[model samples]
Target: MCNQARFLAGAIFSLGLVVSGCSSVPYDGTSGMTDSNVRTSIYSTLDSTALVYTNPAAGAPADDNPWRWAGFVMHPIGVGLDYVVNRPLYSISSTFPRATGYTNEDAMLDAYRQR
Candidate 1:
């Protein structure tokens, strides 16, 4: 009836708002070192998972065994989490200078340079 129709309209409007809020823009970790795009974001996420799981860093016990398979299994889940949760959170926080933890580009660059 009328109530059902109104509920459906409200649901659709809410879905549209949620979808619009999600951004595909790749996070610029290095202040324009690379292009920002959906593809870059996906690649970076996957690459990070691969690097962490495949290369265990110096003197970390080279097992070279079954643990590596976990990375393959987790990569998709990690990517999904990044896209669904992390990216949207970053997008929202990046809008506010205080939220981003840097007042300006100079401060950000200095912090990175020191690291």
Candidate 2:
């Protein structure tokens, strides 16, 4: 009976994941549907473009570690899961008023301008 219950729970969880994963709406930065709304950190254009090219082409030696290969396989899956779970929550939270300080874009741009 316990085994049957566990299987049923797992099936339900899988179904939820499948249903939630079908979001077709593109993330255009703003939390709200309008451009006037400030962009939230949940999905940042800056973050998606945050990759740094520290080395020249063919400059760095590849690691021979097995775990490095495992990470290479898993990184995209983890990032996708993080986005699927957090994006809606962030959008919901953004509808509420913030307590203080500038929005994320303003703060980051201001810091960059200072430098």
| Per-candidate local distance difference test | 0.68, 0.64
27-106, model 1: which lDDT tens digit per residue?
A: 65675464432122223353556655564343243344477678878999999999999998888887775867757786
Please report, as a residue range, the 10-residue window in candidate 1 with the lowest summed lDDT.
35-44
Task: Give one digit per residue, the lDDT tens place, for model 2 in 1-115.
Answer: 9999999999999999877764675765445556443323333333444334332323323453577789999999999988998887776666752543438787689899999
> In candidate 2, which residue pairs get closer than 3 Å at backbone N, Cα or C atoms, i.e. clash?
none
Full-model lDDT, candidate 1 = 0.68
TM-score of each: 0.35, 0.31
Q: Report the Cα lDDT for residue 100, model 1.
A: 70
Clash count of each predicted structure: 0, 0
lDDT of 2: 0.64
